[model samples]
Target: MTKTQKPLVEDDQVAQYAAEGYFVLEKVIGAEDLELLRGAAQFSIDRLDAAMDAAGVDRIGINAKGKRYFSNMVYQQRPELRRFIFGPIMEQICRRVLGENAFLFWEQYVIKAGDPDTTFAWHQDSGYVHENHTPYLTCWIALDDVTEENGSVYLLPYSRSGIKSYIKHIPIETGDQVCYFGSDPGLPVIVPAGSIVCFSSTVIHRSGANLTDKLRRVYLLQYSPEVIMNGDGTAPHGSYEAFLIDGKVATAVS
Candidate 1:
């Protein structure tokens, strides 16, 4: 199918994303690609579990005690991950959403399996690192079908601008505990596999309880302009580092 004829996002979707802070595109990624991502995510999860076992870290949720991450640096952990995250199809959507020449900054995976109590507290991603910088856009790719019964994402419509006023601090053992930035109770956005939900980082969003028997897998990819800074008045480093420059791996700092 041609690029235009292929199942692609519409202008109204983009408008909704900008105004509502999040938009779900139906069947954007095909089944073959979804299987590939599923395999890659499983491998990454296994490796993370092995590493945690070796380190003796508990796989706890953000709200509960013990180590809350099953895996943090999957992009660096698996080179194959870049094949999906940086795929041409995803790039096309990103370009349209953030304008041409949008650079992918980082990626994170949230894997909650079984009866884990590690709930993801409500908070803006920008608050996790840079609280002062623009959060730009985020693409949440689901490897498995996610429903409200399986810990789907909830977001506030049109609450991105008012998020700053609702910022409140809450302490958790995960070292990253913070209340939701926006108080508005927007509609819950539930998407299935082979689909992607895109949202602004400044948007108020949170993952709900995983009530289903199966696992709930999600990949969070954040993109922004080539130039990036921490929102908390700090410099970008480590995972938040800008890696995509001019739509290519940046080899030089200049």
Candidate 2:
């Protein structure tokens, strides 16, 4: 698929994101690109399984029932996946939400099989990382049609304020420094395949158990400004190297 030539994000959408802490873009990815992404995700899953077998260890996030939670996906090795990660339309949205020069901080592939107990606890993405950098943006791309039955993510609208103090560290299979905030603040986000839901890293969000027989797949990508630098001039523990997009740093415009 061809890249979008013009900016996909509008002024009203930016206003909505700032006010609600989240916004949805329907059909942001076309059919062709969506298929390509799905293929890349499958490739990543296969690679993960192979790597685990070679190391003689079970996958860190995979369960015996076939559920999977993989991070730092195929964007590094697959050219097709990198196109969507650094695509023009996504860059436009990131620039509008983050800054003129936002960079790709991290990416992950989250999949929930047809398991009734698969759920992600309520937590903020910012809580999983250092507190020094400004809150970043998380763009969740739905690779499958997401609904309440398939474990769609639930997010709190306008919940960024007073959220930091509520963060509490919790142990999970994903990481030792994982955190949680116990509260159902918002409704589930239901969108179709190829839809993109962008929200603040500080916003409290979680996914429910997958009750449907189909799998729920989502590509969770993050973008941050150059302000992520620490006071001691070092990157945060979970923060990845930023890929400069528009040759400008994040400014205080929003």
Return the top candidate by lDDT: 2
lDDT of 2 by residue, 130-165 (tens): 555678889999999999889989886665444533
* Cα deviation of 63, candidate 1, in Å: 9.9
The models' CA-based lDDT, in order, is: 0.65, 0.72
Superposition TM-score, candidate 2 onto the true structure: 0.82
Estimate, for each residue in 129-228, the C-alpha lDDT of model 1 and write its tens digit.
Answer: 5444555777888878887777778776555445532354576675655665446654677777877888877666677667667778877787876456
Among all windows of 10 consecutive residues in model 1, the one with the lowest summed lDDT is 60-69
Error of 1 at 231 (Å): 6.8
Clashing pairs in 1: 61-118, 130-231, 131-231, 131-232, 132-231, 133-231
TM, every model: 0.80, 0.82
Residue-pair clashes, model 1: 6
State the TM-score for model 1: 0.80
After superposition, candidate 1 runs with Cα above 4 Å error: 1-7, 59-70, 159-161, 164-169, 174-176, 181-186, 230-235, 238-254
